[model samples]
Structure formats: structure tokens, C-alpha cells
Target: MTVRERLMYIAKNRYARRIPLTSRLKAVLRAYLHERGVIDNDNLFISVENKILGARSIQDRLRQYGNLTGVNNEVTVSPNAFRRTFCRLKVEAGTNIFVSQRLTGHQSLEILRRYVEIYGKDLEEAIEKGFEGL
Candidate 1:
């Protein structure tokens, strides 16, 4: 997307987030947005049957997907995992912390930093870089 269009999306969206786009994922969301054409609802994730999906419903779908995909049997499948992973990925990718805080709906930089401190997978590398040429 062009910068103008991306900015417009961020400006107009309530819970704005830019999920990393894969081919199939982009296709899926585009299809979903197309399906929502001319339909206005507060919840973007409203179901086809017009019911707002509650937390439990989303959790159930996550569990189903995890089972279907055979992901990480030792790790519990939950929404927190997705959120923390997103935060970690953004930090590791060198995205500006403020931008990550906005995208992740974190209220403050300190909270976002805590997410980083908790989920950073390359702490050794980070420390090494900090102490480089010492």
C-alpha cells in the first residue's frame, strides 16, 4: 500500500493493526473485506451469521487451528501467545518501539518494554551488540 493509503487506514481505523501479509492471508482478508462491502458494523470480526464473536469463540477457533496444524504440543495455545509473539517479532524486526506500541495497543512504552524484556528471544545477541567493541 502507498503511504497515503496506509496512513488513511490508520487514521480511519479504531483498532488499527498491520498484520504481516502472506499471499494466502492477504487473499483471505481481502475476501473478507469484500464480503463486508457496504455493511457497517462496530465489530470488524462479526460472523457471517451476524453474531459478535466473544473471547471464548475466538479461543475455541485458536484451539481448533492449533490442533489442525499440529503446532507446539508442549506449549498451551492461547491468545496471549499470539499477542506476545507479535510484540516480540516487532521488537526483533527493529520496528520503532513507539510504532510497535501503537500497533499492539499498548498504553505506554514501559508496558511495551516489559513485553520485550519478557519475550525477546535474542537477549544474548542484544547484550552482545550493546557491549560490542568493549
Candidate 2:
């Protein structure tokens, strides 16, 4: 199954919740849980306070960790990095742009376009692959 179609289990608001996650992302989450020794919690991602992490909290903590690790000084630690990377990856992997936009919760194609950066190498590779039969 595709990553977009797989459901991930999590604890939220006094109930269980399931959200879509890619297989690779699922592995990453499982690895993090193993590393952190989390055995019982259903939430794949959580704060140090044992609370399930939401988008805002995850962003805040990511910023804090980036600052602590000196990543903030070298590169901006913002949601844009993740969002844009997600878009670029999805597009590169051949997912439809409109689908990526919906998955990313972007309201417009204009905003989504800003997130997707198509390098010359990507275009060249696509051309080569398409013309390989000839």
C-alpha cells in the first residue's frame, strides 16, 4: 500500500486516532519509539510530557531542538522546510501535483508551486527515462 493509504495509530484527545503515514515514515516512527524506549503509548509521536504531539507543538519543539543542535544558526528551522520537502519529494516520486496539494493541505496551486522546486537534473532524468525506448 502507498504511504498515503496506510493508517497510523495514535492517541488523541482521550481517544484513539488513526492517520495516514507512508511506510518509510512508519519505520521512522517505530525507530524513534524503539530508541526512546516507549513501550505502551499508542501515539507514535509525543512530547517529553507524555502528551501526543500536534502540528504546532511539533513545530515548536523542532525549532527548539534545531536551536539546541545549532541547526537554526545554519538553516532556518521552520515548517516550510518540511512542507516544501514533502511537496518536492511527492512530485519527484511521480505523485500528481493536485494530489500532493491536497495531501499537504495547500489551498491553491500557486502556494503549492512555491513549495515544489524542479531542478534541471530532475527534468533531464525525466526526459531520458521517457525517451529510453527510442
The CA lDDT at 37 in model 1 is 73
Lowest lDDT block of 10, candidate 2? 9-18
**How accurate locally, in lDDT, is each candidate?**
0.73, 0.77
Per-residue error (Å), model 1, residue 77 = 2.9
Reference-based TM-score of each model? 0.59, 0.56
C-alpha RMSD by candidate, in order = 6.0, 6.5
Give the Å error, residue 123, model 2: 13
lDDT of 1 at 66: 88
Report the lDDT tens digits of candidate 2 across residue range 1-134. Answer: 56566674434234443456777877886788678784567776776777787978878988999999999998788777876877989988899988887677666999888788667998999899999979
